[model samples]
Target chain A: MPKLKRTDPDERATDFVESLDRGLRLLQVFGTISGPATLSDLARAADLPRATARRILFTLAHGGFVATDGKLFALTPHVLTLSGSYLRSNQVVTVLQPVLDRIATAAQEISSLALLDGDDVVFVARSSPTRMFSAGLDIGYRLPSFCTSVGRAMLGRLDDAELAARLKAMRREAVTPQTVTDPKKLLAAIIADRAKGYSLVDREAEPHFRSISVPVRRYDGTIVAAINMGAHVDRVPKQELIERFLPLLRDGADDVKNRLL
Target chain B: MPKLKRTDPDERATDFVESLDRGLRLLQVFGTISGPATLSDLARAADLPRATARRILFTLAHGGFVATDGKLFALTPHVLTLSGSYLRSNQVVTVLQPVLDRIATAAQEISSLALLDGDDVVFVARSSPTRMFSAGLDIGYRLPSFCTSVGRAMLGRLDDAELAARLKAMRREAVTPQTVTDPKKLLAAIIADRAKGYSLVDREAEPHFRSISVPVRRYDGTIVAAINMGAHVDRVPKQELIERFLPLLRDGADDVKNRLL
Candidate 1:
């Protein structure tokens, strides 16, 4: 393996107003890890010098976008203000929330809205009862797009070349015994999902978790995101997911797309 | 009147990398008043040369953060990813969502979380079943801090000098007849809020909206935000807000603080 260069020391001496890039790069650092980070951790994650990282963090902190406990720095609830703008400005989330609420109440399971982020799926909105799951799944969580139903639903909308490129880039590590590691098999599953207009993944990402999903389209008929219903395998059988949950997922996606358009 | 000289133009200019600030400034121009902006409009808002603004807009359009229909540019949902990181990293939101949900369900009204942003209060989280008298009370929306219960709760925690400076900086225009624009009266109200550990604003921000709020503290006892319950003026009387809602608001705020800590 080639040696990985961490930071380019020479770039520090240059004076360029890359503040926009610096600010965005600072956000990307948080995506790489889950917990709060100290100044040194942020500097290393963004591949910037400590002084540079400190300046960006200070500005963000002052803007009420980020918070610090004098020791560790983390993103603040004020960030939702920005995301709230998107939720309100767009018709998708507002229309989808009620439909998702209905599905969660009906199935007594977790339902979510996810969009593709490069090769991963990022959860944008979610609804779940307090006692539904042992490990709570909140918004902003990302998961590999290879072994999930929402991933397949999104993948179903891509053309052949785009699908090939995506499969070529994915690492086919087995997350569970049921996970499909072979590119050929994954492609076949995606093709089937396209035919049915929905997808189901059974214990692929986790042993006891299963999910069913459908693609959500915009007014222009372009697939933009996905809605999925998830439950424990012991509670929901594979056939019940297809028969009972698929319609709710499809209707919710349709409702969201219709309102947004 | 003194001319408002644009502050630190050189420092602000250097804050952009390859004119990325010019690009972000173009995006910020769409907030509140201006929904969609033409090319010339964007150039003026960002104070950049027309060609510079066009180049930045072109790049942003390709990045999917902005959309254009040949004449004007509008924000796309993709832009939220930049701010979404802040929502994901904040433990406060994760703790507060359940509380907001309970309050909204219990009261059958709007429940929200807000933080002090300079002289304004910005909504961070809101749970509402329907639109009431306040039409645009969504997440990320900003309102004058002096006119809101959550704002007053947050202000009550500030030191005397800090609070006085904030009042001096605010515009003294009354939003409604009930709004307390007189500095002395407002100061007394804030003082009373501090003594009682909660705040109530009746028909101050809007004629038919009444709210009660309590300060949310961190584990170290620093007030970081406030939680509020809002109802239509006719549904919840001023006396009932203090009697029925105050204790619940305080309890909910305590629950969120405990969970976050």
Candidate 2:
């Protein structure tokens, strides 16, 4: 679980602040752990020296971003403000959240919008009719793109050469038994989705979960993101998903495109 | 507006990482400014030297946390991951979101949960029936505690002496024409809400927006947060809010208590 993308800046860069990078990395490390972590645990998880980790943690604590109880440290709610700035200022999230909410209510399923970040798709806005299937799918949740409906839907918008490069660069893994790990097959699937105007992934990203997605295009018809509706396989058959939700998702995407700049 | 509270740690602390603190402050400054910002604008907003701001921006940019055009910088979606770790690990948000969604759907208004962070209440979870009135009340939105129903409800659970001290320390201002700024009146209102088991704020924090909230207690009877439903004053009168929404909020709060640790 190396969360930092390979695109991370070179440490040798003169202006790169290693301490700030390490501190941010440490914050993400806390997310990987279940609960409060000790100094040793945080240091090991962050792959930093214990003394360095302690200094970073102390700084975080002083800023009210981290909470401590004797030997254990945990993040405080103040950390939410870090993302609040991006989310509030993001036009994609601000404009499309209502569309997703409407789609979720009308379709009685979880609705989400994801943007391609690095080789992964990050959920930027989401709405749910119920709490079901919220795990790992909330706003800010990230997933490998090649194996997810939203990922493929967004990838389908890329030029063939760029898509091929991305697919080759992706570290394809069998997230579930149904996941497509072959590059050629995945590319074909994405191409077909591009032609069909949507992408559907069945039990590929998660067990028993299937999703259908369509790319949301900006005014110039450039794809900006992907919007999707996901459900448990037990509740939604493949045919029902295609026949019922695709039109709704497309309409929602259209609405978003009209509203978004 | 000084977003950092007065409780900010003494910068003279031995382990204080000034660069890290300045980087985090810069991130918040971007949020305050709309869209992309010039380096000078960001430096001015963050009150940092141009050279220092440039270095931090380069580090953030290298980390993919900040995006820069030829002349301007904006936060990238990667910033969301900073909060993602906290939100995903947070029990309060994980446990209360579904409950809030249920309340919102049932009540046909927006429902939210807020926790006291310093003298402000930070919205930790929220659900909306429609996207109406969501401008400044989304999850992670922070508001002064004295004038908000959710804030008052959470403060009501504080011991009288602590509450008095908090009110005395508060930088109360007339946020709206109807906002009660006097410490004594705010304290009395909080006390009355505690006695009645709910807090109602009418056009105090925002014009034409009224909300009713109930304190959520932990298994040990310690107040953990507050849950509320808010609607436009035009849509729901003060009498109807108390008569219809108070019990629903209380029940939601009770459900949260039963489920939370």
Candidate 3:
């Protein structure tokens, strides 16, 4: 899980910080593996020289972002403040949590808010009625935009060229047996979603997970994010999801766009 | 919002990356605000010069960690990947997620995991089944250690001297009417928690929110983090919380420490 791409300081700006990019690269490598990594493990993962990694780790340790068990290097919980920084600054999730909660409660399902990032949809907030979907989804979990309903909902909001580029970039994988992998088919699905004003997917992301999502609009009507409610296929039939959850998702998105904004 | 504490690169290692520290300070500023910020706003919040802030923002933007609307600079959801890195590497929450889910389902309440960081307790993972207390708490939300049950449960694990140092460093603030601001009394409560094998807090951090917490231990039995179940005071009486919620919490913690680890 070593990162191959690195930011070039001299690429565009005169004062772009190279050291900072390296530091972030160091942080990036940690996500790829589980458990504490040795200095060598980190250097190899981030493609940094051992000495350079040591220096950055030390600096991060000093800054309360990294820690050591006297051998392996690991991140401290203080590093969470960084993401907290992003979440708090946006405050969209925080502002919308009560609303998300209400939606989850009313639907008796897992409701979530996800923002489009690169070719993926990153879950920024989630409200679940149970721990069923809690793994990898306590905010910051990324899912392919090609498969999940929320992903399709946001993709539906993208303009033609951007959507085309994203569709082109995606390496279409069939996450489950029901996942749509063809770019053309995915595009058609997104376009249909645009027409329908929401995206509904059945077992595309994971088997037994069914969801329907709508775009979270901005005051300017731009789709900044998407919201959805998901449940096990057994727990929710498709028609029931639309009848019970669609209005809740649409209203929640409206609340996010108009009231929270 | 500006961070005055900058890690000194020359303190022990000459190669300590100062630019990276500045870059993270750029991130620290994001936590204090509630919305998008201009370049100048970022500089003022992080205490960086306009040019320096602009450069760092450019570096971050290039790295896909930050995004811009051609005017205001803000972090992208990819920053969550950083926290995700930490969470995955530890895998504590990921491994325990199903267990937390079960706890939340069994208790019919919000179950969460928190790790101690400095004077604050940062929630690393959460399995909340309802929206009752979902606002302001996703992964990485920080609560004052003194006024929280999860904090006291971990504090209860600390040795006498470390506990004393923490109490001395704590800037006791009355978060709610029932919050114990006295250092000595807080110490006694923590000791009581240690003896009781759990911490019970009633309407201390948030108004009318009652929570009980128990320490999650490593396989070797040393407390690593704390887990809790929270409910409204009206729904859960303290006696019922201890009688009903405590056993579920202890079992959940035991499962996290022994089964997951």
Q: Pick the candidate with the highest TM-score.
A: 3
Better of 1 and 3 by DockQ: 3
In candidate 1, position A237 carries an lDDT of: 86
lDDT of 1 at A230: 80
Model 3 C-alpha lDDT per residue in residues B1-261, reported as the tens digit of each score: 111132433347686788899999998887786676778888998898887888888888888987676575667788888877887777667777777878887877778888888788988877665444453246788889999999999887678878977897888899888999998889888988899999989999999998999988877777778988888888889999899999998888877676544
Candidate 2 DockQ vs. native: 0.32
Q: What are the per-residue Cα lDDT tens digits for candidate 1 across A1-261?
A: 111122222222232335656665786577565557877999998999887776676666655555666457776545545445444544455566677667776776668877775567777666653332211124446677889988888987789778977897887678898888889889888988888899889899888999999999877677778999887888888899888889888878776665554
Cα lDDT for residue B34, candidate 3: 65
Kindly list the per-residue Cα lDDT of model 2 for residues B2-101, writing each as its tens digit: 1123222433477778888898889888878876777899999999999889888888888888876536677787887887788776777788878777
Q: Candidate 3, what DockQ?
A: 0.40
lDDT of each: 0.69, 0.81, 0.80
Name the 10 consecutive residues with the lowest summed lDDT in model 2 chain B. Answer: B1-10
Which 10-residue span in candidate 3 chain A carries the lowest summed lDDT?
A: A1-10
Which model, 2 or 3, shows the larger TM-score?
3
TM-score of 1: 0.76
Provide the fnat value for model 1, as a fraction from 0 to 1: 0.15
Candidate 2 off by > 4 Å: A1-12, A101-109, A128-137, A219-221, A234-244, A251-261, B1-12, B101-109, B128-137, B234-244, B251-261
Model 2 residue pairs with clashes: none
